[model samples]
Target chain A: MENFTFYNPTKIEFGTNKEQLIGQHLAQFGVKKVLLCYGSERIKQDGLFTTITSQLNEHGIEFIEFGGIVSNPVLSKVREAIKLIKATPVEAILSVGGGSVLDSAKAIAAGAKHEGDVWDLFIGKAQIKSALPIFAMMTLAATGSEMNTTAVVTNQETKEKLFIADESLFPKVSIVNPELMQSVPKDYLVYSAADIIAHSIEGYFTATDQPHLQSRIVEAIINTVIETTEVLLSDSTNYNARAEFAWASTLALNGLTTAGTAGFNFPNHMIEHSLSALFNVPHGAGLSIIIPAWMKWHHSHNTDQFKRFAKQVFAVKTAEEGIVALENWFNKIGTPTRLSQLNITQKDLPLITDNVLNNAKIFGIYHIYTKEVVNTILQDAL
Target chain B: MENFTFYNPTKIEFGTNKEQLIGQHLAQFGVKKVLLCYGSERIKQDGLFTTITSQLNEHGIEFIEFGGIVSNPVLSKVREAIKLIKATPVEAILSVGGGSVLDSAKAIAAGAKHEGDVWDLFIGKAQIKSALPIFAMMTLAATGSEMNTTAVVTNQETKEKLFIADESLFPKVSIVNPELMQSVPKDYLVYSAADIIAHSIEGYFTATDQPHLQSRIVEAIINTVIETTEVLLSDSTNYNARAEFAWASTLALNGLTTAGTAGFNFPNHMIEHSLSALFNVPHGAGLSIIIPAWMKWHHSHNTDQFKRFAKQVFAVKTAEEGIVALENWFNKIGTPTRLSQLNITQKDLPLITDNVLNNAKIFGIYHIYTKEVVNTILQDAL
Candidate 1:
């Protein structure tokens, strides 16, 4: 294990009816008013919006609404939402939806105090300092955004997607109710499971020198995801399955998996971001399609990691066979592994490669994944 | 899965030379002056004391020193430290040693504000409303006081050891460098490993339904400890082994293992506290002796949990066999599994049983471990 630092300060309140208690929790943070940012309608009709609003009223806390955040969370919309928040004098951003809206709310919190464009932060022009306190009542279990400092957003005009991590942007509190996940569509649940698996494996297989403890944590999370995903895909309304998935996914990438490991940059995420940016695919679908291809191409970078992954995750014999098992697992869950299957044209592959190279480079072992290498991976993926 | 809520708010600054970053990190918490609390002269001689003090001077922070805290930190010693801290007028408690000193420091932080005796909080007579900001440079791997809200203190006069837990006692920051743990003696290392395994298993075999994700997490941490401990026993200077052990032990009881599961009140802790109070044994040794005996006596009470523990941790076919395997594992690690091996008298057994049952009706299983149950487990241990 190489030297590293780990710090995640998000306070997670998990269980049934956690959202209803959010009002009192906000009181603990001393927020008098909030920007109630979410996607439109689903939450409101389900009575979550009213329940939370009533609770806030009970505490005499006010809120302004900013709904209709799209799946990709475009930059212009973020700017407009920031404008809306500023106009309302909201004290914090209280996001009440899936990853997209929470990601947008994070941007909005940072953007409200930012001097220049919010895109500057995404592009590494300015460091994140203080932000309006952000809180979340997470309805989805996919991104682990509720516990992590990562926020991914898209730029419409440039057709570019990127993520910015700022420690200051961690949610002051996250209310996770697994019951909320039951409202999600089956395909969405499957996609979320794929996303979590990708998150755990990236941290697992990329270690410069793998430690047994870290490997065990990675394997456990992966195994839990595998078991719970099967249960969830079969019955999305299974409360126990939802609860297990909700906790597993959150713990996977909330800085726990990457505690002391080195190497293995999030190459899959970089590639998936390219897919999501140009083709408008679901984030997890982009990952589900990219991971196996990237794994097949990159597995030899650390054969031992792949062997461990094969045995621990899929209970397979060899590293090569494990990759096949992963592919089979994804196919079983209806997450396509090919770019053509995700409806991306072969012409777009080179651009995806170029886009990843233009950004940050991943470290060690597979130390030579340049533009050509990335494109080769994309071609193999196609 | 049962309903539960989990939250850990401690910020862990981990890596090589993380102690040097402490002064800068503490400034963010608005702590200009700290009461530097630690055990013995080891930290001073080990160079951690000078390095931390120099860093504080570099950051323009002031501190007052208080040392000589012992194993199983006593309430009277804590009171003496409290008097010193009050006179110094520091805003925070900076603990620079193992869990004992940190636990004592937390008690001082919580008790300094109250009008009554600090022991009141220990005996459950008072609630900790607020605490001075606490920071730590961790030199120990067990107890997990770095990232939790619990402080266990022993009352030497009464031979009573108890703990106080409150949200306020959560450390503002904890700096964990695997290098710090390198200097720990081999016996202490094995004892801590046993303690970590006990912590992982204490909740692992709880009386809960569908604790899938949580059970996996418990196993992962325990398995990590078992593997890393072996490596450390053979090669103490191995960085990878130390890192794995450090991370696994911390995660063992940082509230992750109990998520959405019925909490098993720590029976090992209950039994061990008496041993620590009377004999001055290492905290982990007491736990190592008590945990397996408790498991054997209580296995029939919750066969499901025991069977799961068997399947996961020991890879045994039956719960009864798993109980035997656990006892053997303890012996293999050079930690005892019986009371008599520690030279604890038969007369002392009843007193320990009486103490444990005075608190929990059900010690660890689904059914209550009343006085009769406690006697049975203790008798089995002997």
Candidate 2:
């Protein structure tokens, strides 16, 4: 096992009606006021907004509402929120939607405290030293943003989707009421499943020092996601399945699966960020397109891990069969697995490859994921 | 899945030579002075003491030594340290040994801040609301005291082995350098393995609201412990095996395996604590003896979970086989698996049963673990 420091201090309130205690949770932290951030009007329509506000009032907490964050959360929206936060400073950021809103809230939190452009923190030009505390009432499960420190946001002007990770960005508390996720659209559910699997497999197959225990944990997560996703597809209201899926997603990228594993990169996320930035495809759909293709190309680089993944996760005999099994499962769940299904073709390969290469450079993986490698993987998707 | 709040704020520094940075870790918490706690003089003989003190000196930190803590760590020792701490207050308690020492350190940390008898915190008379900061450099992998809020200590006068769990008692930081554990005596290693497996199964079997995902995680931890223990027995110097075992032990009881599950109790620990309190048996050895006996007596109450455990961990078709398999494995590892092996006779059942019943009452499980039930389990052990 490789040396690693594991420290995630995010307190999670999980189960039904956990969001109702958001005000109490914040109050414990002495947060009297917060910038309430959300993606759309869906939460308001579903009565979640009123529920949260009533709880806030009950606890004598105040909030400034800042809605309209979107998936592939944009930098402009974050900057606007930061401006609002600076003008009427809130003690913390209360994200009331999915990963997108929470991601944006983290960016705004850091930007509110930062003296320079917040984008500088993402591009490695500046470090995040301090930020307003973050709390989340998660309406979705993908991205694992509720419990982790990293936040991904896209600069619409530059079309550069990037992330910043620092200890200061970890959420103080995250409420994951799986019941809140029952209303997620069917398409988004499959996409979330794919996204969670993507999170689990990146380090599992790519890590140079793959400890058996870490590998088992990753497999356990993937198995849970696969099982729960299938159950949710048939019965979205199955609370047990929804709870397990939500937790599996949170654990996928919450520093638990990747700890003690060395030399691993998020190639799937690296490539999918470009798709979200350029084509506006949902992150998980983009990953569903990229993962199998990348696996087909990269399996030879780590054949043993692939075979182990095959036997342990898919109960398949070979790496090829495992890849096929996963692809079939994605198809069964109605998640797009081909570039054509995503309306991208061979002609679009260059643009996607170039975007991915740019991200690889920023991610410090350009030496391995060069333009050639990017194009080849994209071609496999085609 | 059940409603739960999952909040573990302990920071873990895991890897080779992590102990060398203990002073820096303490400094990060602004601890200028610590009461260094340990078990025996063996650490001194092995250069661990010199290494730790030098690191403290390098970081300009001050410390006072408190050594000679024993396994089944006594409340008297903790009270002594607490008195010393009150007389010459320190910023934190730095535990430099295994679970026993760390458990004692946590009690000392709580006791130092309390005006009442420390035993009040263990029994139901008082609660621990605050404590001096605690840090640990672990040289053992059992009991999982490194990253948990709970601390177990035996009251010598009352012959009660009780534990206190509070958010305030969670270690500020824990350094888990598995290399430090490579020198563990073989018997202790086997005992530790038994203890880890015991920790994993307690929640796995007893939880009435068992989430499948949580079960999978428990299985993963158990499988890792079983695999790593076998490897370590053959090759104690195997770094990766030691690292995996240490990490698995930590994960077994660090609130991960039991999260989202409800209606669970640590009956194995409950029974084993009585043994430790009454006869001074090592915690793990007592557990190995009591586990199979308890399983034999209680499997029918949670038969489905037993069957699941049978298939998942032992690959057996029946719960009976699963219980036997675990017992055989314990025996194979040189840990005692029956009361007779522990030098106890059937005639001693009443005494052990009475002690366990007293504990069950304190644990609020007297209705389920009645005197008859405890006696029956003890009779089975014999």
Candidate 3:
């Protein structure tokens, strides 16, 4: 166990038809006027547009719409949202789609109030002092944007994919109606499961001497994801299974399991950002390819945690077996575990390595992974 | 596996020397004037008083002391604290001790604002809509007052032990420095462990259709408690073990595991209150004596949950063995299983049954536990 401070104020509502309460919850914070943000109008087709509009109308919550926040949530699109928010003066945000929509909305919600460029906050040059209270009708379970205070945005101009972490950006409330997820396509369901597993495995093997209770909490979530992801991948319409995966995915990166550990390296995420930025690969697929490769390369440094992971999650008799079991599970789910399958090459290795080394800096690992080692991990994945 | 809502906003700075940040965290909430609440003067003797005072003075925080609170905190004492608070007009409360001290502080914090009596709120006669912010430096982690929205207060006038649950009573911040538990007496440690287990048993067997994730969560806590309690019972100064128990107890009934569970009857608590109100036994001792007896009476109704409980927590392959194993564990900790061993008589069973029936109502068997059933359970315990 290690000394740590843990707190998360995000209120999560889980169940069917929970989306109907969104307008009422937002009204508690006195958020009346709103910017309804989304990606590619998928929410409109899924009936979220009508459900949310009817909810807002029933509650007399006024709002304007902003569509076309792209897959990677580029800086320009967020600027456009900031401009719309300034011009319209919407007091808060109502994001009604998946990760990209919420990510873009969170960035815009924070960036709208700041005087200077929003990218400054992403680069850590400025603090996000405050933001419009963001609300989510979470239609996707992948990015875990609802519970965590982290949001990743890409600067298409500089090709610098950046993440911002601040308490100010936490959504006032998140309405996670698992029924809303029944509309998500099969490819996305698979990708989302991979994303959730990556989140847990990184935290699991890297957490340093966690308190027994915290370690057990991580184990519980890992067991849940392992159990539920299979059910979800088998039938996307299995609402109970979808709900479990949704809840587990949210709990995975929501700061509860990271209570007393020092593993802050999101290398899987950092590397994935390169793939997502370079080629529009979904975030989960990028991580799925990189995770096992990173594990094989870095397993020596965290053998004990890996052994615990093996015992608790994969139920393998040994640590090595656990790693193999997890790899097989990912393979079984139609997610690519090798970089070649995702079309990366040696030419892009230096850029991906630079991107990871420039960002991923977890503190408690026995070895400091420099740029060369990052290249090796990426090359191994390839 | 069931519809639920989960949100806990208490900021916890955990482990050794984390108390140093108490001033800074308090400053965030804009508290300069403080009501320093505690039970005994153990902290004053152990140098924690000096540490807290110096830190407050260094940060220029004004303060008042209220050490009159006793264990299973009384209503009149709480009234006294409220009276003092009205005269002093402190900004917030900073409780430094175990759950009893913190629960008393919570009562005072809530009662300070209301025009009516505090006892009225405890007995469900009043709706307490709000409260002042309360914070605690949790030394003992038994009742989980450090991280929950419940406060159990004993009304000495009525000889009635009761509780009040409101969102307003949740601690603004909780500093859990496990190092502080080194000075906790062994008897207190053992009794507190008993209480933590009771929290889980009530929570786990409460609902038949409880989310499968919840069973795993409760099991994690039970498993951790079993391991850490054994270590701490032998060596009270085991900081890591103490810390593990501390976190487990907090999570046991803090709204997470019980979110979607139905019919969580605290028959053990209701039964324990009868003994506590009559004989002045330690609350946890009262609970330990009452729980297994109640289990024996009720296990046949929720046989599957009981069987699962036996398998997970007691590690008994059979349901009967699991019940026996739990009794053995309780006896191993030096607590009695029978009511007669605790000096209660059959003549008292009816009155205790009356107390339990008239007071709180939670039933795992989904049938309202009438006075006759309550008497039968108490009679069986004897």
Query: Pick by lDDT: which candidate is best?
Result: 2
- The number of the candidate with the highest TM-score is 2
Better of 1 and 3 by lDDT: 1
lDDT of 2 by residue, B1-382 (tens): 9989999899999999888888888888888999999999999999999999999999889999999999999999998998897899899999989999999999999998889989999987988889999999999999898889999999989889999999998998999999999899999999999999999999898888988888888898899989999999999999999999999999999999989999999899999998899889888999999999999999999898898888988989898999999999999989998878778897777888888999998887999998888888888887
> Would you give me the overall lDDT of model 2?
0.92
The candidate 1 chain B region of ten consecutive residues with least summed lDDT is B358-367
What tens-digit string does per-residue lDDT give for candidate 3 at B161-219?
Answer: 88887889889889999889878777787788889989988867767667677788888
Ranking by lDDT: 2, 1, 3
| DockQ class, candidate 2 | high
Which whole-number lDDT from 0 to 100 does residue A172 have in model 3? 82
Question: Residue B209 in candidate 3 has what lDDT?
Answer: 63
TM for candidate 3 is: 0.95
- TM-score against native, each model: 0.95, 0.99, 0.95
Worst 10 residues of 3 chain B by lDDT: B359-368
Alpha carbon lDDT at B305, candidate 1 = 79
What's the lDDT for candidate 1?
A: 0.83
